[model samples]
Target: MITGEIKSQIDRIWDVIWSGGMSNPLEVVEQLTYLLFIKRLDDQQTTALERATLLDEPLVDNPFRLGKDELGRDYDDLRWSRLKNMHPEEAFDVVANRVFPYIREMRGDESTYAQHMKDARLTIPSASLLSRVIDLLDAVPMDNLDTKGDVYEYLLSEISSAGKNGQFRTPRHIIQLMVEMLAPEPGDTIVDPASGTCGFLVAATEYMRAHHADAINSGKWREHFHRQMFHGFDFDNTMLRIGSMNMLLHGVEQPDVRYRDSLAESNTGDADAYSMVLANPPFAGSLDYENTAKDLQRIVKTKKTELLFVALFLRLLKPGGRAAVIVPDGVLFGSSKAHKELRRTLVEDHKLDAVVKLPSGVFKPYAGVSTAILFFTKTNSGGTEKVWFYEVTADGMSLDDKRTPLLSDEKLGALAVLTDEEHGKNNLPDVLKRWQSRNSTEKDRERTDQSFCAPKADIAAQDYDLSLNRYKEIVHEEIEHRSPTEILDELDQLEKEIADGMAELRAMLLGGAE
Candidate 1:
């Protein structure tokens, strides 16, 4: 099903170019969305017509009532038949103005209210582009379940294109890793405050499917799916709309994706609204400090994205609800008023589950900031029992010239070390060995000397700076057992090569001047 959908999507894209239209992939996708909605509405109307005919009744519930009239003011001048053969620009204009307006009216009906189609959200492209897109998308049967996912997936990918907005969308692979580490349960409500394209929610759903397939299939999952399993929020209306479709494409219809900035402190009422929250929030972004200061002061008391989101996540979760979030590395060690309060709250007030340091290039092609994964649980006891930290400098991937993900290697390494059960005083030698090697004594986990673990006692000594590097030791590579003469020879050759290069550059410059 996924394969066919992908093929159809490719075909649609090809047709747009063949029909004499120029558009980037992202622009083309925006146009595809407008058409897909119309086609789906048409399909719904057709189904209604069939059912009404069989039951000997009128199609009273057909909200769009697409075929009932010749045309409405909404469709510019293009109708289905007219659009198919017209010039690309003419067709596009008709669809953008005429068709979109009608679809907007139909979709906005209170009865059909949904996060994805909450009226028209697309920044409709030019008529020529819209025409080509419509022609392209029309090539596929938009109502086909398989094709729909493919088209939506394509759009989701396009949304991640450079300069669109925000960081490039979080990759699905990384999202899956976060969900697996957090291990959301059956009845647990999963939320992503900065959901962007809903990558985390989709991953959480997949996690549920794999771990609780039997429970999900018995229709028991409906309760969880509708009310518990997923919640997402974002400030960008476009992102919210895109996120809605992303969830729907993955079978999460009627998703609870609210359109609001989760990092803003003014929205505290909406915080503390979920159980499990996973997010890759908008990075390097700041909120209104003066306005949010009152609410924020209660948490970190400083207006920073990392601190605000931490407070937001804590407020959102029910007591004992877990969260795994990604934040800039500076948040882990930066000396700021908010940073201090953020650490105090996590290590002292909440249980710090684990801190996994990530390489700087994970967000390459968009954001180059080094990052860390903070896995924490809101505890009933109001104090941390134990905390684990992994200072992963190299996940088997070079953080140099080329930024490639070594998922298989890094994931396997992390899985081997991260135990699901408590690591405190376990008779488990393998887990103990891994932990001990990665960290010194448990006290080292909290100490201010190493890059990884230190106990509560050590943490208290540092006034509870929860920076992983404060405790985890940076182990230097072992020096090779080579003679001093051999090392000197190597350095001498390197120096000679540098001198030769300089001499050549000097000669070239002198010749050019002459």
Candidate 2:
């Protein structure tokens, strides 16, 4: 049930955001995040204290550490109870003074708020607004990580409307699909260079736990998972902070998510990089070559998402490292010089494993751009091998014909079908049926009939136009096959009907003349 309390609280929060002078939704979310984290921390400490006292634990080691004043009133450093005493605007100012200092100090030279602090003010709504928000948050239980995750996810979804700061967050289901396909092993180092809200990081963590539950529960998980495996980087400080908080909420302690413009050479050199890079890099944004060239390669490799990120990921990945990335459809078939060069590099220099073409409406609510997923491995020079291609015809559903929630559909599962002994031979008939129908040649020439297997020669011949639509020919079923006589009979019946209608019209005209 959509509880009234939750909806009302959400509305109030929205009202506050609109009422406040904050222009950016992401910025508004940032302010809310700061407040929420402080409140939740205090709540947890309070609960921890209660639990400890109930169990008769030692009083010397209080996790909360709430300070006390001379009048017997608790003067906890930054708890909501103490802040509640001040006016909302004043309270937010105080919070900014205390909490932000800690954050900036922790972030050192790389803090996003560091420069903004010069002119930063905590001006917000009135005390009443703050109090109501606090009351609303109080209703939420802060004991479990999943609960916190649910709240965070909702907030991200709410603020993910398009054309907001050039940020269109990737859908969670798509993130889940990538993580599941990659199958990040427990303790495997995972990184997202363009970590928007850390969706990939969170999904990767969940994927590991779900796949290797026993190992995760055995308590050695943290030792393996922490600084060793999970990593991320982004140019946006605001995004980095959100990503860090999100990783923390998802039980990832000390997430190494950082802020770095990866395309620049100097920034790339200064940054501590990663092994497996999974990212949907920002596209359509013009690159400042004068600045970015210090970190990014100067040679005009490609203008599209895949080429830019491919270069970056290749540089980021160690030898034999794998990369799965989301790219625009243009990268698959664009005839630009950079595009051809990048494709040649992938075929001749690296292992291009698979390409999955997603439906155009995948990002409906946020964006209507058609996209594709490219999975590849970083290797030395290699021959042209078979690359599996899957086209997702339906991407969930929508009631109002906008972006709808991601739902599981059996028909769309043909994209990730397995052929080898590892995934079992029996599990591939439906997919193979379509694949073979498209290409009947023993040499596997690229067929425009169905989504068929293509030979290297044919791909080279076509200049490597990898658009699935070009190859996956739609086969329309014959509608009620009829013999020549039956077709003639139907045409004769239709002719008689037309003749009778004409005769009635003529009769009416003659009556009028009479």
Candidate 3:
């Protein structure tokens, strides 16, 4: 959804940073995100001042402090609004020596964005580059929420489009499909354990704003939405800052995007805490048994990071809490005991809702590993009867490295209005529609169809292999039949023609001899 104007603005920032010799796209975004956060802080401070005055209260938690700092520069000068117009050297002086430390020492604020800024640094490389980035950032209007989101998304897209660190970028439409399927509610507690750039959290917020405008705008739910609704974990400090800023731009004031190695850390404190989980954790990874979390190890003894993430999701979900997670196809049909046991636990211990097969090309140009989405609810006892399965062959884009869109903006996502022919090119809309019919019509569909349901007993009989290919039936082309009378008439006419030709040849030979 990043348009040309926003794209160009971000592109200009990227160029400035690259010219300064910072080649890592994530770092470029990280530096830009920090400045954007500072600008946002100034705006937030203004709002706080007005509200405190209106309530006849003293301003207490301003991002800027009173009077002078250790360097004798006024604390006000450290703000983006004031320092942005200063001379390049002075601006760099404040940002490098003053602003960076100010944010780094911003430890008292309980907001999640502040939590991640504890180790923040200003790595914009040079004063001129910093100023150019600021001018570019200031020119693009962030006043509109939609434009703000578009800008952040474009900044993140540059990381993927750069072709080096694209593993961090999930296809935007895929994130939308997951969000739409989850349908976030006002009070729902959401978490993404491996939240690279927090795309899932951003999408969930957009969906909530679009679908539940009345409730989301109300004061009670609004407080929950801003303060406590979303959480994300990432070990990389740079990613944590970028992801938190992404949520902030999308209007969530304080998302819990903090530092934690999801697989290495214990889930004891957060066990059964969240109401819903949405994630696509890093996969095809192995961990030492000693390094893995004990609680997760207890879920199903394994070193596979993918399986451990699934265990973490199970522990994170409150009873009756649901999750929709993307996993490598190996998780579906791995022959390992851990894999079989995990699939069994989902079907027998809780409720396994669906397994959606994605095309192998879905993650192309970064990773070609085949993946699938698993939907389940955390129940103490078994509730799964029939588990739905869907195969998404195309996601409105070329299934290659280019990943070019095959449809216009309006015809791209899960809610797109696409015809049958168009649906062949993009299966997301159909996936969404058929997901709703999983219990009813999907159950009646033949295995040869794109989607169908399988009974729990059937799954157990096959050792709980959830791969769609295991259950999907291939459609065979029907054969054309011929009648015996038509075949016999053609054969008889062919025999008579052969006899007449033979007689003429024999007569000609005898005449020639005479």
Candidate 4:
């Protein structure tokens, strides 16, 4: 979690960007990400230099070469530490002319990060605004991975409104819940098909480091952690850039964060290629049949982006690969053939492990569409015996536009120490606990409970409808009411008492008059 002071600093930088004529929230964040990336390069170079000096060893590879560029400007001046001390005009000139191009030209061993920076542009409009933003960003503590990741996430949160293509950031707690439930292993290959800012991948990486620290430290696992374990795909260049930077700051050195429209292309080359998948793809968009991917259409013949994404998940996962992804509630019980076929595919064709229904207001102030998380495995044959269903009411935050935190910092996420009574206010921790025991205690739970399992036969009887309400029995409390005669008796008694009081009042008035 970012401190309030750090959040305020980020907000101030946002204000500067907006005042400088970059009113689009996405553009503001994109620009900030670029600057932060530049700053990170400088920080890395400085650390490398310090380590080399301490060991009295020469540097092996310097990202910052000590030389002038073809434009006759000193490359050393473009370093963040040196540029911050220059006059506003000189700072602006160097950044716009030198630093932007330098970063655009930077290449990693795999060149994924530099590939997305091909269109990098300096859009801060004025020298003063640029200078002020630099000062603000420089004050932020990006020395540690936790703080840096938090700061970047704080900045990403500013793009609260939905984008043109129905893209919006999934709530971090929601992402955490999915990642925790998935419990990514260090050796597992993970992918988020709609990797907006790579939140899912980042959360998975954090979970691995926290739980499987020893596995990550080994040479084999360490190599995977830095290079091949994480992959994300996004069509938007801006999102790709931001998502790539997000992974880098979180310490994934060479994540395959590249640009690809997951639903538009054939999956023949990469089908069944990943061990795990996690995503919350865009919902409710329609695509032309001719323009849609033929392979996805073959899996589920529909242009609905939601259904296509579900099919895409199946295609992307190898047999025995598991996935936890969010889908709109309509996918649960829609009357359309495509919807039914997809649900049937999960239940009868593969292992549909669980369906977690989220509250409608969870995506409030941007979308009020009810959604659910589908946990399933690609078995290429039926394995779903009993499907667990959990209805998540509160996720440690108010399900409103503001999404204010409902608990203190210490009592959040999987480690929340709330009592049973307090747990009612946040269902995340309970969800995790129950999920672990789904095969045992959850199997016998009644339909009226918050979470219960429904047999696959029952689901098939309903034509493969996965909506919790379809099978969840509501235990309506009986309301007792008074009989009409009893109510009349009480009214009659009150009326007689009122009349006696009236008579006594009249007698007293008459005696006084006499």
Which structure among the candidates has the greatest lDDT? 4
Each model's C-alpha lDDT? Answer: 0.62, 0.61, 0.82, 0.83
- For residues 139-254, what per-residue lDDT tens digits would candidate 3 score against the true structure? 76666433433444455544544333224456778888988988888889999988877888988998999998777777579888877899999887767777877776677767
Evaluated against the true structure, the overall lDDT of model 4 is 0.83
TM-score per model over all chains: 0.65, 0.72, 0.80, 0.87
Which candidate order results from sorting by lDDT in descending order? 4, 3, 1, 2
Poorly placed runs, candidate 2 (over 4 Å): 1-9, 20-26, 42-122, 139-165, 213-221, 270-273, 294-300, 303-306, 399-401, 406-458, 478-514
Model 4 worst lDDT run, 10 consecutive residues: 144-153
lDDT of 4 by residue, 1-514 (tens): 3546677888788777777778876677777878887788788788778888999999744567667877687778978999889999999998998888877776643469878877788988899998999999998877543444454455545565444466666777788889999998877999999997898898998898899888886756998887889999988787888888778766676789988888776545789899999999998678998778898888899889999999999999999999999999999999899999999998888999999999987766567889999999999988999999999888777777666778875566765778987797788889999999998898889999999999999999999998898999988899999999999999999999999999999999999999
Tens-place lDDT per residue, model 1, 273-385, is 57788998766656666666356668777656767878778888888788889988877777787787787788888888777776676565456778888888887466676
Estimate the lDDT of model 2. 0.61
Model 1 residue 50 CA deviation in Å: 18
RMSD of 4: 3.5
Runs of candidate 4 with Cα error greater than 4 angstroms are 1-4, 45-78, 108-110, 141-164, 214-218, 265-268, 478-481, 495-514
**Which segments of candidate 1 are over 4 A away from where they belong?**
1-29, 33-116, 121-165, 393-453, 474-514
- Model 4 scores a TM of 0.87
| Candidate with more favorable, higher lDDT: 1 or 3 | 3
Model 3 per-residue lDDT at 325: 93
